[model samples]
Target chain A: MAPSDSDAIFSALADPTRRAILSLIGEHEELTAGEIAAHFDSLGRTAVSSHLRILRLAGLVAERRDGRFRHYSVTPTPADAVVAFLTSVYQNSLEQLASAVQGAATSEDTPAGRVEERSA
Target chain B: MGELILNNELRLEACPSELFALFGQGDAAVGWLFGSEAPLLRPGSLVRLALPLGGLARSPGTARVLSCQPNRRIDLMHETPWAGRVVCRFDPLDSGGTRLRVRVTIDDVEVARLGAELGLLGGYETGWWEVPLGLLISLSGPAGILGRSTANCAQLAVEEINADGGVMGRAVRLVVGDDATDPGVGAIAMRRLCRTPGLAAVIGMHSSATYAVTAPMAVAKGIPYLYTPTSEPTAEHPLLVRFGETPMDQLHRALPLMAAQTGGSRWFLAGNDYSWPRAVGATARAVIERMDGHVAGEGYLPLGSQNFEPLLAAIQRSGVDHVVSSFVGQDHVGFQRDFAASGLRDSIRTFAPLMDDAVVEHLGESGEGTWNALGYFVALDTSENREFLRRYSDRFGSCSPPVSAAAEGVYEAIHTWARSCRAGGGVEPTALLSGLRRSRFNGPRRCTLGGSLESLLLGEATRSGVRVLDELPAATQAS
Candidate 1:
């Protein structure tokens, strides 16, 4: 709902490596941080850790201790912040469009020549 | 390639003996290459070719020749698709089918390339389209001989497509199976789907059990199993195609909607005790887990159980907020009736993606207000479904399919297999599977199958080669 949470989620997704991380999770089901870091093209473990940390902080992922390894899962459809934003934006636009179209149609004072049913 | 040509291009590997079948028709150099019914040469005309090995290649295209000498010269000609003219002049031996000096001058390069790849010389076109057709033809009969004749939609589609020139001018031969919904029998049925000579892809398997067992066969053998059932997730192998539905693809869309609707993070799962149930259950578990929901309880039972008193009691106990039931066949009927009678209907509603017309219609009042994972609902508001229902009711005495089971998928599989066979450059399973994967068809449902091996999942492929609706159309489906 706030600007800060949006920045956090978008910033976490900003890196190309993070995008690649999302795809890896999709393909392999779930992966530990170490296992995910293993898929990178020569990126060191520390760098991967920061990326994972960013994802964790943004609530995009949740970590569980698997023995010595900390495995992560994409916080299933993450509805806390980012999903809420996208949902509200699209929902509001749809609502506004409906009102605008309804307003135009019922306005009898408008010229008949200008009045036309727009393909929604 | 369309359904027409694909049906005729049979499986080359299963029946190895097809390579040496003797249909006792005289060799027309051209006639022997193609089948005898080719419109290339005149009747009783003699076309000869110089041999690669030795002697003169003498051949008559469907001619009634009187006498012939040994090893030096011979005569016969029949119009065939293999070549314009075929001359097989044999130096007469003692007995049996002669090993003649066969020389074939084929006019088409594409035809020659296809022939060379399959290692077949001039055996494609021949006969009165019925004589030789009845020879090895005794092997696999024309479509609808599995004899139920309950659904000849695939055959009708094949014939129609063939009449319109076929996928590359080959005739598709659709095959019928008695899957009986057993896994092992389904596997065997799938084998016949691929290995039977001249069949393109197998547009068969109405049971998820059959498709699951057969999915491996299609993948290992490189035969495209065009699942038209619309509910099995058969996209695990490149050769496995779903012209139907997989629950995961559906749930990815439906659960999101349901979650948004109920705002509940808890759900329940139930299905008949079979391969489909377990696999789909596991998938649902995974999906719910992914969607941030907890599975409250799941119920599994063999197909024939009539008593649902305890399962109903369990759901009540679990306090599960949402439920999904994956039951097929008469079980759907029994469950609906029992569910209606259970008095738990108000408290425990379910979403079943596929329930047949037979069960739903039979249920009458009981079927009201229930949601099924439906590609084609009896009351579907779409024009396509309305027309299909009308035609089906007029033809088979039902507005909707007896059950959506694999009926349409089977119908689509037939067409898909036929089409794949036609488009397959050569009559090989690998090519046919690839061809079928690349196809998308508009049928009773919007059906498409991908060639990617991961798409060959048996548990979730649908008939008509489309992704089975995995979930209700709310959260994930693009409106």
Candidate 2:
């Protein structure tokens, strides 16, 4: 099943091992499965492959097969999408908050639109 | 002490305006800084800094905006507990990145001390700022001694771009591949680089023979490829652009002078069997005949052929006063050493259109009196060239490879590509081509390209080093 964009990005970024793999791929153009696996000496190739499969499914990483090796590279479009989504969220929420504050009636000399200070 | 000041600068992979907008504009500034609602910053707008107390008493302060210069500077004057003037200056970097500087001068030291006592600065960690990651760019060339010099310069160009803020506010990452001066290897490297996702463009192919095979392949793949060091400037492929001086350009600029210096009408030709050398030889022959010089002998050596004894003997017997050579890379070094050992330089002064610093360094005393033509030289006395040499030497140091025209071509290619990338606003082939056509820069040795791939300045390599002499007129270059 194809995961949703936010779910996929969060899932892909959830694992420390996957994040490390993504960082390694980011530093290079593309890293073969064997080359990527070589970085984790203690882990078996199959274990690393499973993690790569998860990342590929999440759309955070793209894979190209050549001969016996499958090369993986980070697709930054998803990260860009995440940034756009966050920016939109911030913009909309702030706009709504600003209008709500402006629409309210004034109270006390401190001004009603201004945030009230709570003394400790 | 008077007013204690704190200053910090960060190189961020973002445009100055974009960074300033995030910090000084409406909503975005508040969201970025405090993750809460804040009013639009006007000259006298009051901002409430609601310090999030970490298991301590909160100290809320009212800070008044002193000034707001869009994409430039924003100054804030605090009135309550932590009284200080927080000045944020945003400067655009050359690499399309932003250099954001923040300076805080505490006028009321006691207030700052009280805020510190309340664990506002230490616990909240508001003193530290963040810088985003740099973007990535890739390069390919002959990997070893043959290509490393060009690769080094390509890397240097990227560094300068990144320092300036990178292309379009993104940091540049250099992806390098070794062509090994072989066509087959170059093909594989090109394929590997093509498969690389987010690759902006490809630059650097040192050998014409390698380029001849790889250019068509890269064209077929629709990659925006900039041909550097290889002098065959056929713009047949839509996606391929030539940045190096063509053999015709070099020969036309330097041949007449070389013929005059030799004071003879008889000449011989020798070069590696390749598209560039063959083109150069043809152009030389035409130019020499035009100057009333006749070709006495000509020989084409297959690459990796060390035995130049027969060829040298033929030139020696032909009574040719000038020997025009087109040998490239390590082969050129080997041939020059052999030519010097054969006692050819004693009688026949050689004219090589492509000989560079690496060849000269390898030839040492042998290359002493030889003549060469190129677009750039490390020994150029101009301020721009001197600055280039200074940066290169400062970065790579004394033991670094000798700077050559080919290497400088690689450097120029990257800068041109970056500029075009900026102008075109993207790295797509058509965008880059359009941008490349519009790119211009004042390069080393007063060399500049306004539009298209024509280099206005050309130079001759002497015993002292490359001396800028002839520059083809714009009309002649256009023709």
Candidate 3:
């Protein structure tokens, strides 16, 4: 997934109801829309389904068709993508700092690289 | 200890797959790393790496592929003489490129040090110790009580390192050189130390004058030198690392508290006529002036001036209630004894930045009511200090020299050097120097150089013993 896709996943995760619904789906292999709504008494079926739609759009969940019902299951790709994106963001800053230091060092006398070459 | 993690990242104009292919194939990673004609990189497979420091180490070391996630992460655990682990990760960058991060950790101390020497690896923490390599390090200080106490701390550090299996799986032998508190002899000892074969680095805790001569000499010879207990602000040097509180660090945090408690704006500055004393006096004067306080008198005595009677009389005539003295060694002890005997002890409030537990103990009843503020004290009751004291006493006994901040500075320096050696992947001068720049960890007294300046812990001495007054916040480089 592209790094920009993290924005969509983050937006979907921003809502507490969506996060809780995602956690419930992750706990069970798959949950029907009716079964998910039953767990959250405060949230109506339309509200729960709306949250599921956002999660589905973010690629955080996969919807499977049963005989006459639809079941949602958590997808691992979005989470992995987020991890990769965050790691890259952190890595980029460190690299920039290292480059800045290296540039400053080079402006001065480049000390002799005293390391010996590897023998085959 | 957990495995050391060193992370380096680069943004390249390529996708994750494109970057992963560079390492996924045997041929691409050949010259860059593994160097074998047909280097296999599958998970659970064995791979051989061409050692960078070939003359100083074995040629090709073997490693096992711990795990591999295509287009993301690859972990390799080396099984060579110096065992270690390396992990490379790739991710997509916002600028339509790939960000590659590399982390290397050596399980074996010797190999880790060597690995750190040859690559872009920076400093890191170490997990365990296994000493198959023997690294000889030299320690120099005065042979007097203060210097001996510093040397004892170095010995304690050596024992601690050996107990952990030494750096890079190599046992360390600490060679002690006596400077005898003389700059001429100290320079000679340092020159000899710089010439010693197989010498990894040198840690010294002598006077600032000794450091002035010896530090430059060590740098000139391309030897790494870590100096402790000298407050003379040093000029930038490639091979020298100083571990001491600058006058600004001590006075800025300590003086205001001292002035507030004693409720005196009038101050007297008396110290030995040396570069360190001169610098400290200047710092104290600046801090006092900034606090809207006035200097009542300034006294400069020769380094070995035993007669404080004249100085005491001069201060009494000046009617200064507060004294800021920077005498070192026996001169400090002498001043304390004489000042106490003069009956001025009851009226005048004295503050000495260099006074430590040993000086306090030597002063006995005479040093009572004297106040000292510094980065470390033997009386600090932190868990790390407690563990250090427990270990130090166990090794050296209760009769051992009192562990001053100067001694603790040396102890911390050794551990810092060891970690830098490991981070640089080897003990080569250039690698060690680079690694030392990036090194960071907590030790006894929590002594550390967070940046260019060593972080200081401020404390004051009470009539009964030393009590920690405050901890100075960490400073950045040059701040």
Model 2: DockQ score = 0.03
The sequence of per-residue lDDT tens digits that candidate 1 reaches over residues A9-107 is 655644435544543453334688777767554667888788788878876667888678888766764424433322232222222322322321211
DockQ, in order, for the candidates? Answer: 0.01, 0.03, 0.01
Model 2 regions more than 4 Å off = A1-120, B1-144, B445-475
Instruction: Report the lDDT tens digits of candidate 3 across residue range B298-352.
Output: 8888654667988989888877768888887657877878988998878888888
Estimated TM-score per prediction? Answer: 0.47, 0.55, 0.55
Query: Model-by-model lDDT, in order?
Result: 0.45, 0.59, 0.61
State the lDDT of candidate 2 residue by residue for B190-300, as single tens digits: 554555556667775557766766677677777767776647666477677666666666676567777777787888999988788888889889889878889999999
Q: CAPRI verdict on model 1?
A: incorrect
Alpha-carbon shift of residue B433 in model 2 (angstroms): 2.2
* Quality of candidate 3 docking, DockQ: 0.01
Second chain TM-score per prediction? 0.57, 0.67, 0.68
**Per-residue lDDT of model 1, residues B1-479, tens digit only:** 11101000111121212222211222333122222222213232222211111012211112212223333333332111111222434332233222223332323432332221111222233222210100010001111111122343544565656676655555544444434344433443344344444544555435565565667766676555556553545447665556555666545556555666667777778878877777668877887898888899989877545567788788778887677777764456557667778766666545555544433433455655555454543343458656655655565432112324345455445555555655655446666665665654454555445321122111121222223333233222443
